[model samples]
Target: METIRYGPEPSQLAELTRPSGRPKGVVVVIHGGFWRSRYDLSLGRPLAASLAAEGWAAWNVEYRRVGNGGGWPGTFDDIAAAIDALADVDDLDTGSVLTLGHSAGGHLAVWAAGRARLAGPPWGRPRVAVTGAVSQAGVLDLAAAHDANLGTGAVQDFMGGSRDDRYRLADPAAMIPLDVPVRCIHGTEDDVVPLSQSTGYVERAVRAGADAELTEVAGDHFVLIDPASAAWARTLQILTALG
Candidate 1:
């Protein structure tokens, strides 16, 4: 219900609420726009409002767009700052964190939780430990995405630079080794990010000893955010199971 701004200027956190008398947990929803400055984070408001009505406090977060170095430290830093801000808000349950992101956001969602696993990343472990993740059409493999040239140069901008960045924070395929609880929902008909992203994720997660499930649904990239679509139903079910 209240929009909160945290971190440095230009860097902000946007949120929506529905006042569910008592919240069961906090769900941080990351908006996907290939991390560009033009897209803004307001689009995810509907998703956050929906989750808030379902007895969950939804924190819709935004960070700086891809920096000259691709949005490295800055993007990552903003994510950590926004999640930590939830602690100051009353009724938030720090122990439970359910992060959901679509497309580019998905990559950040998983990365935020497993940042500590990054061999030599400057930032330390994140405080926003994920209880579960519902990634919809996420870019799980940067190497794959880069090869496919997803989101045009938008993804590349978010990533900052080359393969080194992919290894450090871009590739979820490599980070899956930490084995966090993740649920990937992809539209069987999706063309943007494709079901392959989730499929590859399912394979890697299982191989890495993490708990992961891949569920197929009907529709395309946009349907995942459309409440009327089957993709939304799958998302609800996934979060329900996690909660």
Candidate 2:
């Protein structure tokens, strides 16, 4: 594994590599855990390493989360910086870079992809575009997530505020007009984020005319992160299609 800091605050981004004659691709993974400190990108090591073992370079990213300097524009900013920094790493196929995020990180993945593919005020425009994006059981609708309020005050804390925060920074349902290809995978038994989150996102994305695909399998939220779980295989298929 390798590490890099995208922010001045020592926030880290990590990667796991498998020896391949030529890299198949690079998948940048952002962890979920509702953007809290307790849920570091390190927890997703199994997923990252699994991706590597399955033949892709896995870049696991950790940025400022709640209780640190993260939240709102700062989180988005750091994500962009990390993606940009990832451009310099040696083993990756630059044109084949993909962002795969779980839970809250899924929300981050969509936000980051939108910014990288579209030009607008909220974001300063991406330095470069990525190949694709994957969101696994993400909080796509900020207002909805805040309303449901999963994991105690975890959502609010990670967002650092009211529903408006979700609207501005974390609402991929509203932001899915993005040009980049996006594929979402969610477990049906996801007691945490419900399948509606992914379904609603896909519906809205279709309405927006963006290229999107969503799949539902049998399991819970964390299954996506488990190397031994079925959700990981679905994730692998999605990541490969983008390549």
Candidate 3:
């Protein structure tokens, strides 16, 4: 594994891992911490290493979170810069790029894939297009998260507001019909994020004519990211199918 910088800030970095032989593609792993400083990229290191061992180049990205130089546009900006930086990586197939994010990272993964649809001066264009995305126990629906008060007002803290526009911009559910294929996997017993977040987003995405679907697994929130768990096996199955 090698650490590479995508921007000036220390948080704007990613850990790159290459397999023994030619890789199928690159997988961008985004960690979950409810978009807070307390949780860093450490949560994603294990997953990145595992992907590398499975013959995939894994770019585990770290971005500024709430309490740091993150929140709102800053967090969004960091994610955009980190994913785009992969274009500069040598000997890698960016055309087959995929994003796998857990929890809050899941929201960003799906959001980043749909960035091309955003209006204005293109806040940030990914140099390498994202072909597909997987959200593992993600808070996909910002409005639902805010309404349920997940993480004790985490949605408001991350978005910096409770306005409708704020929710619309940050909510992955609202940004449905993304061009790329998106799969959301959630644990049936996940109390932290809830299965509804994934199911709700998939429902909306399908209704909007997006290639989206939801898979329900057994276990709680952490099991989805735990390598030894059945939930993780299901995740790997989905990822391998993508390839």
Best TM-score goes to which candidate? 3
The positional error of residue 136 in candidate 2, measured at the CA in angstroms, is 1.0
lDDT of model 3 at position 100: 97
Better of 2 and 3 by TM-score: 3
Q: Write the per-residue lDDT of candidate 1 for residues 1-243, one digit (tens) a residue.
A: 787888546657667574558776778888887777765677678788778777777888878876422275677777777877776776566687888888888887877667667655354555556677778888888787877778886556666556574465656787776546888888888988878888988897888789988988888887888866767877977888887
Q: If the candidates were sorted by their lDDT against the true structure, best first, what order would they fall in?
A: 3, 2, 1
| Top lDDT hit | 3
Question: Which residue pairs of candidate 1 clash?
Answer: 1-17, 67-71, 69-160, 70-160
Q: List clashing residue pairs in candidate 3.
A: none
Candidate 2 residue pairs that clash: none
By summed lDDT, the worst window of 10 consecutive residues in model 1 runs over: 66-75
**Model 1 misplaced stretches (Cα beyond 4 Å):** 16-18, 67-70, 119-122
Please give each candidate's TM-score. 0.91, 0.91, 0.97
Candidate 3 C-alpha RMSD relative to the actual structure: 1.2
Off by over 4 Å in 3: 120-124
Q: Candidate 2 lDDT, tens digit per residue, 1-243?
A: 767666568665555554345667778789988887766877778887788777887778888887677876677877888787766766566677788899899988888888743446546466546778899998787777778887677667766777763475457766768788889899998998888888988888888888998988889898888888778887888888887
